[model samples]
Target: MSTRTAELLASIALIVFSLGLMWTVHTDGLKIGWVPERGPGSGVWPFWLSLGMALTSLWTLVRWFRRTTPESRNEAPYIESDRFGLVAISFIALTAMIFLVAIVGTYISIALFLGFYMRFVGKHSWPMTSATVLGAVISIYFLFEWQLSKYLPKGLPMFEDGFLWLDNFRWEYFM
Candidate 1:
């Protein structure tokens, strides 16, 4: 499809999606305003965010109709032939990562994804790729598991046992 057609379709889709999200939030009965003790209700952020998205989408639609935006005026193909390979590879990698999350756990899947993306797609040095992968894993582990006390998915039983061992080690040495 042409860029102009893609832009128009995306804008309309966003508008519909935003409206649906807003309706869902309203129907859930979560107050969109401030509560008695709490500063803001649970639905306040989502409702306002959806409203903003809808407004922005409407603006984009208007611009598209007027052919004001560059994308709206451009008739070029959305994905060029040469660039399609990269896009396909990236999509496949993302899909693989998501699928691996259910089999190897979040941390392992994320590490693999980062490693593959950085080393292959980004063409970064091995040291740089390894450091980035390690940093991301450590940061996520500390932020969610250590600080927030929220345990992420551990995948299969073997992976769960491994994570439990790591948790025990962390508690024993760090805590």
Candidate 2:
């Protein structure tokens, strides 16, 4: 209804989702190592995050309840009416990018998301958008793909094998 109400609702929703996610992660074998390594389990991060969310939500709920006055109750909207559309669209774009992660690889999705945000939402010139997107892609390519040697999620096994096949191609013969 109001900004405070909306934020309280959103916080409650996040608290519930985080708790559920933590439970799921805990049930699905949090720790990979047993005795020697004593590394953090899969649920470790989520568990702590969930705890924080729960505490924050409780605090917000308490504060909102305590701040109940006639004037405070009828405060201005949480977000400006004119900015709602832009905010909603930006949130939708972010959610769409997350959903697309399993469809396309991270690199392609990141590129597409950046292009959409920069050119469409941000209203930047085409040249600026193109340059920024290219720079981001190249930087990520060098960072994770080359320097860190971390393999990002490639969606499915068939796609992974396809990339592997392409990667194994020797360029020395052609050179």
Candidate 3:
């Protein structure tokens, strides 16, 4: 609960992360050697960078054990209970948004995300959230699909789908 505990936990996490990075670099064929005629291989930079991170985290771990720093002297709690809930909610929302994007199109996913964020987090009224979502969807549809003629991910067989080649539809042709 104290700052010292938080620092130690973070250091441990960093150590684990650095180990994973080292494993990835090794698996990816990190070649630290430079060719005679050419420059270093792709893995050279990553190999050294990961090595540095690993060493730094190890140092941090040592520092935590020593508790010699001013930050360690202060025993303030790292994360308050109230703020943790907000962080958890935001993270869950992001995961749900990804799932929604895969099931629905990007347009609908963004609209839903904005609606949730506005109504719940921002404490906006339903009408304001709805209008904002609608306006955003329309802007995205026009800017990316209509004007730029780009193909974005579409969901469903009907209205929920984006990038419907509606850009190709000419008013003159209809006339």
Candidate achieving higher lDDT, 2 or 3: 3
Candidate 1 structure quality by residue, lDDT tens digits, 28-127: 9989998998789999999999999999999999999999999999999999979998999999999999999999999999999999999999999999
lDDT of 3 by residue, 1-175 (tens): 8788878888889888988987888887766779668799777887778789989988978877787766566687676777888888888998988887767877878888989999999899999999999999999877887688676676666744324445435333542
Winning model by lDDT: 1
Ranking by TM-score: 3, 1, 2
Better of 1 and 2 by TM-score: 1
Query: Candidate 2, residues 14-119: lDDT per residue as tens digits?
Result: 7788678767777887753343566665666777777787787777666667775332364578777898989998999889888877877676778889999999
Q: Given candidate 2, what's the lDDT at residue 153?
A: 69
Q: For candidate 1, give the lDDT of residue 42.
A: 97
The TM-scores, one per candidate, come to 0.60, 0.58, 0.76
CA lDDT for candidate 1: 0.97
Which residue ranges in model 3 land beyond 4 Å of their true spot? 34-42, 69-71, 156-175
C-alpha root-mean-square deviation, each candidate = 5.8, 7.5, 3.3
Output the worst ten-in-a-row residue range by lDDT, candidate 3: 159-168
Candidate 3 to truth, TM = 0.76
**Candidate 3 C-alpha error for residue 104, in Å:** 1.1
